[model samples]
Target chain A: MYDLRELTEAVRTFNRDRDWEQFHDAKSLLLALVGEVGEVAELLQWQPAATVREDVKAGRLHTRLAEELADVLLYLVMLADETGVDLGPAAAVKLAATAQRYPASKFRGQAPERQ
Target chain B: MYDLRELTEAVRTFNRDRDWEQFHDAKSLLLALVGEVGEVAELLQWQPAATVREDVKAGRLHTRLAEELADVLLYLVMLADETGVDLGPAAAVKLAATAQRYPASKFRGQAPERQ
Candidate 1:
């Protein structure tokens, strides 16, 4: 229901309303990302992959997963946005660079970290 | 080695080189996202989560994972960019929405899908 610009506006208003922007500088924001990720990881901590899969299916996992994931994405997008980065075309270039770095024959059926 | 704007420019050039912009409309771009995601999944197909962890550590997985993940992210960023979306402010907005939807009291020690 929320398109990107409107959504971004709301976030700005929220920050200004609470005067949270000063603290949301790059370092703090990045730290927040780590913190949120920790929270997300906590959901799967001490749990087997099977349980994690089940939890996802049952909608019984931590509430922060989406929140944290979104947080991470939001930060990344925001950082890029603030820096005048255009995501769409930037990605296309990354893909090209990645293609050169990791070819399909080497990549096929490979895990993310492997390549 | 790449900042966001330069990366985006490279991507745009890559597309223009192939005259691919016309096909990069919202619909096609979205479909491309699906395809990239599928490639990422293929790395884990029939494999245990343990294997995924190992692959990530040892760098034994498909090359496409980063490529695809970046692709999905790229499309999202581009879509937002073209539409005049600012990542940082927009994300702040989403965080606010999410914070309201799921409070810390409800979020602690939970996996992503639940709550």
Candidate 2:
């Protein structure tokens, strides 16, 4: 039920209130987003897919992955806000394009089919 | 102006229409998200911050970064949908926690000061 605009604005206001906008230009935000994304990847690096599933089933993903994802999401919102990219709409448009590019009829039962 | 629910639903329907849901349970989605995140990080890996900005300004980041980011965002929406996590609110809450954790006054003029 939450809106992307609201989330973007909340981050905008938080940054403005703290005068942190100075630190969040498009490039910085992108790099920061990449950094958090790296952290998320690092947690799973070299682990077998089965082990990853076990980590999830054991409730081990709730903390680390959630926090890393939260960080990635936070920086993504901030970056989109600073760069004037409306992520939801941009994503919607991209999804449509992707649907065209990778027609499901041709791509179904493809990769990630649980190996 | 787009809603998170809409984006999530769009991705959900995309998967369902293609019957790709079989490949996208929570664990699968998380792993997919992580894979896209790594792709993003690899683009900027080991490059100095200055080079990153140059890549941004030289119009080098448009295609690769955007596509990677779009993939990341798409997977993120799908994962949140499967897990019942509201990314917008979860991010808002986490951002607030982050604001408190790293007070801008104390952390500003600290990192990503363009140097």
TM-score of the first chain alone, every candidate: 0.68, 0.86
* TM-scores, all models, native as reference: 0.46, 0.74
lDDT of each: 0.47, 0.69
The interface root-mean-square deviation of each model, in the order shown, is: 13.1, 3.4
Candidate 2 TM-score over all chains jointly? 0.74
Cα RMSD to the true fold for all candidates: 13.7, 4.6
Q: Encode model 2's per-residue lDDT on A47-101: one tens digit a residue.
A: 5765555564346665666677777888887766654456776687788987897
Pairs of residues clashing in candidate 2? none
Residues B21-102, model 2: lDDT tens digits: 7776665676787777677667656657645555544465545666666777898887666545667767867887878977
lDDT of 2 at A48: 70
Docking level of model 1: incorrect
RMSD of 2: 4.6
**Cα lDDT, model 1, residue B19:** 49
Q: Which ten contiguous residues of candidate 2 chain B have the minimum total lDDT?
A: B106-115
Measured against the true two-chain complex, the DockQ scores of the candidates, in the order shown, are 0.08, 0.37
User: If chain B of candidate 1 is superposed on the true chain B, what is its TM-score?
Assistant: 0.70
Q: What is the TM-score of chain B alone in each candidate?
A: 0.70, 0.81
